[model samples]
Structures are given as C-alpha cells and as structure tokens.
Target: MTFKLDPKMTLGYVQLRVQSLENQKAFYKLLGFTIIQESATEIIFGSGSTTPVLILTAEEDVVPRPSRTTGLFHFAILVPSREDLAHVIGNLLEIGAPISGAGDHLYSEAFYLSDSEGNGIEIYRDLPRNEWQVELDGQVNTATEPIDFQGIMALYNPERAWIGFPTGTILGHIHLNVTNLDDAISHFYLEAVGLDLMTNFMDSAFFMSAGGYHHHIAANIWQGVGAPLPPKIATGLMSFSLILSSTDELNKLKQNLLAQNVSFSEVEGDLFVKDLNNNDMIFYTQA
Candidate 1:
C-alpha cells in the first residue's frame, strides 16, 4: 500500500472543454503559450518546446460549469527563473490581463488568474531547493506571504522581450476540488496513485507529490464535502496526464492501484482512471 513512483514522474498537458475557443486562444496567447495545433473544435497550447501543455476544446453548446462543483481548481505552470516569471507578470500587465490574486508561498512566488472560460491558472517560479524551508520530517514548509512585486519587477529586463514561454516552462502542479478530503487523501492519490502526502492545510486541503518536491497535485474540500461533479458538457478540466519515466514505473502504479482495489483500464498501453474527485487521470510512459 506504500507504493512509491519514480522520482522523475511529472504532469503532462491539461485538457479543458471551453465554450469559446477564440476567446481562450486569445487569452493564453497573451500569456505566451504558443498554438501548437488547431482544429475545428480544439486548440492546443505549448511553451518553447514541441510538448503541448494545454489543450482547449470547445463545442458550440458547451456551457460553463457551476462554481460549487468538483473540477479543476487551477493548473499551475512552472517557469525556469525569476526573470522569466517576472516577464510573464509584466506581459499580463502590458496586455491588461486581469489577475485574480498573487502569492509568495515561501518556496515560490505565484500569480493567479482565470482563463476566458473561468478555468483557473497559476504562473510561478520556484525558489531553489536550497532556499526552501524544510521541516524535520523532510517535508517542505510553505506559507502564503505577500510577494515582493517590486523586487520581482526589478529582475525584469525590457530589452530581453521574450515572446513566449521560456524553454524550461512546464506543467508543474495541479490543484482540484474534491467531494471528500479523506477519500482523496487516503484511497485515491496517496495509496492508489503512489503519491506522497507532502503537507496539508488546516484539514480543508492537502498537497500530494511524488518524490517529495513540494506538491505535484493537490485537492481541497473548500466547496464543502460531498460536492457534486460538474455537469457533463460543462467547460472545465475534462482530463489531464501524468507521464512516468518507464514501463516499469507504470507497472508499479498499476500494481498499486490493484492493491488499493481501484479500477482502471488500459487502452493502447495507456492507463485511464477516474479519481475520487471524478477527475480523469491518464497515466502513460514517456521513456
């Protein structure tokens, strides 16, 4: 029951069912996500690399999901440096992008915003590992202090004028709204999915990660326990992916899920399952 995943385990692209592809595209484009691919109903966004990070799919009849439902809370994007992260803040300011909030969470400084479809987004830069505050249990201690905006802006260089997300930008972490905190923490992410419980808030939320790097995924009961799933055809997170390092690591996860009696299906060598929060998890091997 104490299964551990490969340390290199990382998240992949997040797919959201949006209502207005045009509006969402325009918004993410301003944030420096490049359009990697496009079709009649979907537009994919990526950073400097060919790897896609976000997929926006919209149908004519798609509607916004209600706020008090179980779905994505936000998807956090990790950039490589303070300068790049500051550049993003400047870009949003220059374009008049509305910011929901910003935070300096000890280990990282982040800015929060929502997409055109109301899907939450976080753009952040991590302080170096040596700079993080660690607890006696080897867990990282994080807090929400006010970010040093003036200092962050001081790192900004207008001459660099970076056009898109820097090469090292990646899908860092994802937070979700779940119906039950206990089920999500005990039965789903920790035991079955092989993530380690990194740390937790005052019982309303918990952060989980693989290989102990702050939090890779988190869930909260802020909407109240027993929250209902978002309506189908609702515009929000439909699914997201986590890529493992190898087939062996994938097998370990499969065994962990089996041991926990969690149902999963294999399709074309990829594993598919739904979490306790009704969030779709697609696990696949990248190396």
Candidate 2:
C-alpha cells in the first residue's frame, strides 16, 4: 500500500521512570540536555527550551531492576544534521560519558550510550533522503561500518554549539526487548498498528513512518524473553503512545486489526494492545 505519513505525527517526547532523580539528571546534563522544568517527583530535560526530550519521574520506593517488562528500551533522539550530531558527540567526549557503540548505518550514523540508571540512549542524524539506498523490493539498506569519528569531531565549532534541539525534530524511534519477534511484529505491523514493515531479522522487527524514515519502532527478542514484565511499582517505561495523522489512518488501523482477528480494547479513544513481551502500546489520532 502506498501511504504518506505526517512527520509532525512522530513521537514528541518520552517519559522515563527513574529510581534516582539526581543521577538521571546528572547523566542527561552531560549529554547537553538542560532541565526545562522540575518538581519534587519529576524533571524534564531537553535541548534547554520549552520542549523536553526526556522526562524523568523519580520513584524512590521501588528499586530498579532489569526485566523484559513494558518499560523503555531506549528513546532515540534525532539531531538536526550531521554537524549537529558531531557537535553533540564532541560534547559527550568532553564530558567523559561512557560510549556503548557506534555504527555507520548507511541511512544514518549513530552512537549509543547508557545512562547511570541503565537507560539506553541513542544520538544520531539521518543522511539526506535522496542519498538513501533502497532495493528493488523497496527495502532500505543499512550497514555497520567504521564511522569517521575524527571527521565528525572536526565539524565541531564551539561557536555553533548545540543549545537545544530545534522544533520539528522528534523522538525518532523506540526500541523494545520482546519475547517473540514474530508475535510482536504481527501485533504491531499486521494487526493493531498499520505502520509499514520496514525491515526484519530472525528475531527482530522494524516498523517505520509511512514516508519510510527507517523505523519508528523496533522490537527484538534480545534481553526480554522468558522474563517477567516490569512491575508497575518499578521505575521504567510506563507506556508508548503513537499518534496517527488523520482519522482515516486511525480507522484503517482499526479495520486492519479486526481483519487480522487481533484482540484489543479502546479506552477514551485510544486503542491499547500488549506485544508478545507484554509491553503496552497505545494508538490515537489527531484528526
């Protein structure tokens, strides 16, 4: 099906439940995000403007533990451009933040890191749309190669520092650790949500924006299989909500789910479903 997606409907921000507010704030600050608002139980950090990129809600009574629960995998952040990404990388290096991995995914270059509370964070910038290589079958190609770390660093200009993310930038994607990849894919792609399937591995699934911006949400049977879901008492991902651009898109998604015989419920206009890993995903439309 040929579908067009409204980029404006992309993810706006993510709220993470953190066990220690102090540590979470310090970690994000090192990545150059400034707190935009704060309360006794919650702190919002972003590009230092009104829009927050990440939200941390402190819950001290519950200790943190790793699980296959419906919490967060990692909230991916999109940078304005390659140089902007490089500037952030340079700043990260200056702060001595621990780097987990880096890759040249033909479509984009990305660097990964984990926060003090063990939250995964990805900083990346996409290549120009025209530069993306697609197969005859319309599948996008990505590869992991050595990135030009030094070359990117050279683009860093102290005068052109990254103050905060610009408007139109968004939470590009959300990855989750699920129990079964096929089940998760069926639930999200062919069933409840009508996002086009972008790519897949034996144990992972990727769904993308209608304009084909790689993947907006990805799930894998990696760390969260044969594991228990995160307790509501624990601090982590609460739920992920997808905003559709139009009422037609929302209805189409609902129709598709019915055709697939998928089981779900609606509450106050939001369609809710649990993936194979039991992570809750909610869908709504701006209309």
Query: Once model 1 is optimally superposed onto the true structure by TM-score, how far is the C-alpha of residue 157 displaced, in angstroms?
Result: 0.9
Which 10-residue span in candidate 2 carries the lowest summed lDDT? Answer: 1-10
Candidate 1: which pairs clash?
Answer: none
- What's the lDDT of the predicted structure labeled candidate 1? 0.87
Per-candidate TM-scores read 0.96, 0.83
Worst 10 residues of 1 by lDDT: 182-191
**Residue 119 deviation, candidate 2, in Å?**
0.7
Mind giving the per-residue lDDT tens digits that candidate 2 earns over 127-201?
Answer: 988898877777777678898888888898877655555444557888876555556456555444556567664
RMSD of each: 1.4, 3.2
> Counting only residues 3 or more apart in sequence or on different chains, how many pairs clash (N, Cα, C under 3 Å) in candidate 2?
3
Q: Could you tell me how far off, in angstroms, the CA of residue 82 lies in candidate 2 after the best superposition?
A: 0.5
Q: How many residue pairs clash in each candidate?
A: 0, 3
